[model samples]
Structures are given as C-alpha cells and as structure tokens.
Target: MEFDASHSSSSLGARVVLIPLEGKVIRYAFKLEFQNTNNTAEYEALLLGLVEVKKLHIKMLKVKGDAELIVKQVRGLFAIKNERLRHYRNHVWDKIEAFNSFSIEAVLREFNSKADSLVVYAALLVPHPDFTTNTYRVELVYRLSIPDNFESWQVLENDK
Candidate 1:
C-alpha cells in the first residue's frame, strides 16, 4: 500500500493506492471533512491504508508513504507530541495489529507518484449529483464535506 495527503486552506485530502502481490492495483481517495494539520492528514492516510489492507485479510503487508514524520513515528524513531496525533497513532497501531506481519517505510515523493496523484485528484474533486456508483474494484473517489464540529463525515462515492 502507498499513501499520500494533500492540504488546502480549508480542507485536507488523503489517498491510498494498494497493489496486491497478485499485481492488481486499487485506489482509494478521501477528502477529510475536518480541520487537520499536514501531519494529521498523513497519519489519516496511513491509517486508511491499513484499514484497507486489513479488510483484504492479508496476513503480511508492506506500506509505503512520503510522510517522513508518520513513518518515523510508526517506527518509534520520533515522538508524537500532539494529542490528536497520539490518537491517530493509537488507531494506526490497532489496525496494524490485525496483520500478522506489517512494515512501513518512507520513500521519496518521486517514487510514490500514483498515491500522490490520487491525493491531488481528491483535493480537486467537486461533488456533483450526476456522479453515483458502487463498484468496489474500480477507482473510487470519496468526496466528504462536514462541519468542523461534526463527529463523522459521510463518504460520497463515485467511480472514475
């Protein structure tokens, strides 16, 4: 799995691209509805990627991302100072526990272009009524808009 995050003035977006050992590529894009820092968005992207891997019942997995902070934190080389990050870190650990073997590495952005493009695409997406679909294997974009105080955001799914 590869992950990336994009941030704008008013919103954040995350994307995860999964390439199974069988060589099938699947992409997931998300627009975060809440206010979050760049690090938070990175963590969110990592967590979302883990969730996707877990759903596949994969016993062993390797994750890659361009976020050095998140990679270091997950490897225990950096400390999580922010309270929100601590929560996200815990969630990441929990999801990772589901896998029998898991490892995450930080790679340069140039090497992670697929995930990077997914994030950029998510950030630029505008919701429209004409988009509606529920196909799992195709490229999926989730446009989520929520209030700053909202506890949960609804995912609007579209196929691309």
Candidate 2:
C-alpha cells in the first residue's frame, strides 16, 4: 500500500494506492472538509488504507508513504512530544497490531507520485473528464478520522 497527503489553507486531502500481492491495483483519494495538519492528513491516508485492507481480509501489508516524520514516528525512531501526535501514533500502532504482519517505509516524493497527484487533484476539486476507470475513486470526508480530542472537542488546540 502506498499513501500520501496534501494540506493547504483551505483544505486537507489524502490518497492511497493498494497493491495486492497478486491482483489489480486499487486507488483511493479523499478530500477532508475539516481542519487538520499535514501530519494528521498523512495519518488519515494510512488509516483509510488500513480500513480498506481490513475489509478485504488482508493479513499482511507493506505500507509506503512520503511523510518522513510520520513514518519515523510510527517506527519509533522519532519521539512524539505533542499530546495530539501521541494520540495519533497510538491509534496507528493499534491498527498495525491487528495485522498478522505489517511494515511501513518512507519513500521519496517521486516514488509516491501517484498518490501525491491524486491528493492534489482531489483537493483541487476539478472534474476529470478523461477519467474512465473503475479502480480509482474520490470521496469527500466531512470529519476527521481522529478527533482533535479524545474526551471532547472542547480541548482541541492549535497543534500546528
């Protein structure tokens, strides 16, 4: 699975490409209507991909993304100091533990170009008249995958 994300003053978006060990590749992109940082958007991308993988009953997964910070934090190479980031990391780890086997790596942006472009396209919200594929999909998400606060939204902060 490959994932990437983009964030702007107006929106947050993410894309995921699921490459089965043997089968067709699946591509997914989503535009987030809520407020979130680029790091959270990266986590959202992975979370969305993991949900789809779980639905397909896939036991083993190798995830690749261009978000170096997120990848290193997930691998325990970087310390998560912020409360919100710690929450996101813990949530990601919980999902990873459910798999029989899981690995995540950080790749160069060029290597993750497909997902990166998909995210940009989704964020732009321009219709692709040439799009005629059943394997690719874009969706609009009205909420965050992980809430700003575990207990309540009242505690939300400007983590960015």
Clash tally, candidates in order: 0, 0
Q: The CA-based lDDT of model 1 is what?
A: 0.73
The runs of at least 3 residues in candidate 2 whose Cα sits more than 4 Å from the true structure, single-residue gaps closed, are: 128-130, 152-160
Write one digit per residue (lDDT tens) for candidate 1, span 1-160: 8999999896577888888878657777777766678988888788777777878788898999999988988888888887566667766876788778889999999999988876865666643222234311223334222222223311221121
What's the lDDT for residue 153 in model 1? 17
* lDDT (Cα, tens digit) per residue for candidate 2, span 10-77: 77788898987788888888888877888888888888888888888889999999999999999999
Flag regions of model 1 displaced more than 4 Å: 126-160
**lDDT score for residue 143 of model 2:** 75
Top model number, lDDT: 2
What's each prediction's TM-score?
A: 0.77, 0.89
